[model samples]
Structures are given as C-alpha cells and as structure tokens.
Target: MAGGGGRSHGLSSSRSGPTSNLLFSCGKVAIVRTVKSGPNVGLKFHGCPLWPVSV
Candidate 1:
C-alpha cells in the first residue's frame, strides 16, 4: 500500500472529460500520465494508484 497513499494530491486538474470517471481496483481515481521513456514513450494512459506494487 506504499504507493497507494501520498500520491492522491495534485491530480484533480488532470482528470477531465470522460476519463474523469475512471477508477482502479484500489478505489482510487486513475490519473492520466504519459510514458517518459522506453519503447512506449509518449504513450498516454490512465495510471493506477497502486502502480509498481500490484493490485
């Protein structure tokens, strides 16, 4: 649950349109983020609040 907390702030502005209603298994609102590196760079996605820690 380390990644689930302390990351919910500063994300309200990112939620907009149809994607604003999306939610993950952790009951947290998904945030939109773009891949900064790797082969999927520049690809946009709805980031899970528990990322890197699994559901």
Candidate 2:
C-alpha cells in the first residue's frame, strides 16, 4: 500500500515546466544560471534575481 502523510517527500512535480516561467519567493521571475566555481561548475540551473546579496 502507498504511504500517506502531511510531510512532503520532496518529490512533488512543479506546476511550471521547462518552457514555463518559474518565480522566486520574492516574487521575481527565476533566471537560468550557470555555476562559476566548485565541483558543480558549469552546471546550469535556475536562480533568483536577488541572489548573492549581503545581509
């Protein structure tokens, strides 16, 4: 039988597809980004417009 719970398993499908627009928590549209450094360098993914900000 399938398991059921209130907790999310981090396997939910996003309503936005590859061609669809993805928005950030700040309400800004997410942008495609490329990793500049580290083991995942050159790895492309979606990012926020207000990233790398100083607190």
**What are the models' TM-scores?**
0.50, 0.60
Find the 10 residues in a row with the least total lDDT in model 2: 5-14
lDDT of 1 by residue, 1-55 (tens): 1367566533443356654556665678876789999998998877876777855
Off by over 4 Å in 2: 1-17
Candidate that would win on TM-score: 2
How many clashes does the backbone of model 2 have? 0
Model 1, CA-based lDDT: 0.66
lDDT of 2: 0.67
Per-candidate Cα RMSD to the true structure, in Å, reads 11.1, 7.0
lDDT tens digits by residue: candidate 2, 3-26: 676753223335777676666656
lDDT of each: 0.66, 0.67
Give candidate 2's TM-score: 0.60
